[model samples]
Target: MFSRQIIPAVAAIGCVLCAALSGVAASAQTSETPYWASISVSKVYMRVGPSMNYPIEWVYQREGLPVKVLRVNEGWRYVEDPDGMRGWMAARMLARTRAAIVIGEGAAEIKGEGNASAPLRWRVEPGVVGELGECTDSWCEFSVGGHHGFIEAERLWGDGEP
Candidate 1:
């Protein structure tokens, strides 16, 4: 009787220990990783310093600009912009949305369709955001402000197989 009672008690304790260890391991997986995220919250505050009481430096005008998350600690993440500016911003101010850019020395033509020879619907100023879409070797489809079009692959950021 004593031996049988000891076996059941030990098994129950073993089960509790396993459960606790697994819970700790699962929480470790929930931590942050480096990736590009965006600004979803309206009026995301960029800090003059890292804490909440710090003065506002700039208000994010666009809702979705791609940002590289450098480090997350407590309530803030250090980030670097596409243009390579580094600053500390509140984690709540950022969101997981993707955005794109137009690169090169000349203007990007927004066509009515996804062909170079397609009719031009509008012209996007370099560094302006267009609705992102699929692509080929030399071009990626895009849209903006109710217009869908294609621009050269070299003229876009976050495009063509990223």
Candidate 2:
């Protein structure tokens, strides 16, 4: 009789534990972050702290440079650049534009489609910055310096597909 009573109690505890675990898993999934953005202006200062009184750590001159926004604090945002430099920047200096960095050696072919045989649109060199567009399968539409086409997703470093 004690075993029968204890089994139901144990099963109830297991169910509660499972529910708690699932809740934690859901919270973790929802917390995925460090969203992408780009510099809105031609020049901006990356500060050591979130306020203007803080010392400037770096000065960025590129208007379309991509940065990963780690978090927001009042009027400032903590960001990481393509070179992995982390600093606080004025939130107004960043924009929602999606951009990507060309990786690997040699130039990446900007094709007309996702296939290797697709018409060549442009040749983007490694480290080139480009605006990123829709991605499907293993390719994404990329435009850099007036050249627009599709590039293999593996060669890009921003938005979807790692």
Candidate 3:
């Protein structure tokens, strides 16, 4: 009689434990973060503390580099730069400028600089985000869409730029 009763009790405890575990798992999944966001302004500064009075330690410049937002506290946020530099800054310096990456490594080729024979184009360093532009195989032009020259597709980020 004791064995029979204990078996059901053990099974009941197992079921309760499984249900508790599942609930915890669900909560964890729902609490994820949108920490990584694209910089939309020409340049935003990451400060040392959390205000303007603080020194500017780094910047997420170039209008489109992706930044990892560590956390938002008070009116400021702690962020990590692409180069792994971390700092805090007031929230007003950020804007809606669109940014993108060169994808792989090295510089992208900028074409049409000279006669079409420059078909090989020229290369631009990666990690720089510029406005998207027209491109052909091995050639693309970029600027901040206007600031710089027509860097090659291999070095830009856009519909075909990348």
Q: Which lDDT values do the candidates have, in the order given?
A: 0.71, 0.86, 0.59
Whole-model alpha-carbon lDDT for candidate 1? 0.71
Task: Write down the lDDT that model 2 would get.
Answer: 0.86
Best-performing candidate as measured by lDDT: 2
Off by over 4 Å in 2: 1-32
TM-scores of all models? Answer: 0.61, 0.76, 0.44
Better model by lDDT: candidate 2 vs candidate 3: 2
Candidate 1 wrong stretches, greater than 4 Å: 1-34, 48-50, 53-57, 112-115, 160-162
Backbone clashes in model 3: 14
Candidate 3 global CA lDDT score: 0.59
lDDT of 3 by residue, 44-125 (tens): 8888897888998876555566555676665676766556678885555543233445656765555556224555434556
Worst 10 residues of 2 by lDDT: 25-34
Q: Kindly list the per-residue Cα lDDT of model 1 for residues 54-152, writing each as its tens digit.
A: 887766676666667777666676777657777778877786555567767777787766677888877888778655677777778776777777888
Give the least accurate 10-residue stretch of model 3, judged by summed lDDT.
Answer: 153-162
**What's the residue-level lDDT of 132 in candidate 2?**
92
For candidate 2, write residues 1-162 as lDDT tens digits: 999999999999999999999898665434335788889999999999999999999999988888888877767888898788999999888887999888888999999888899998778888898899998889998988787899999898875822
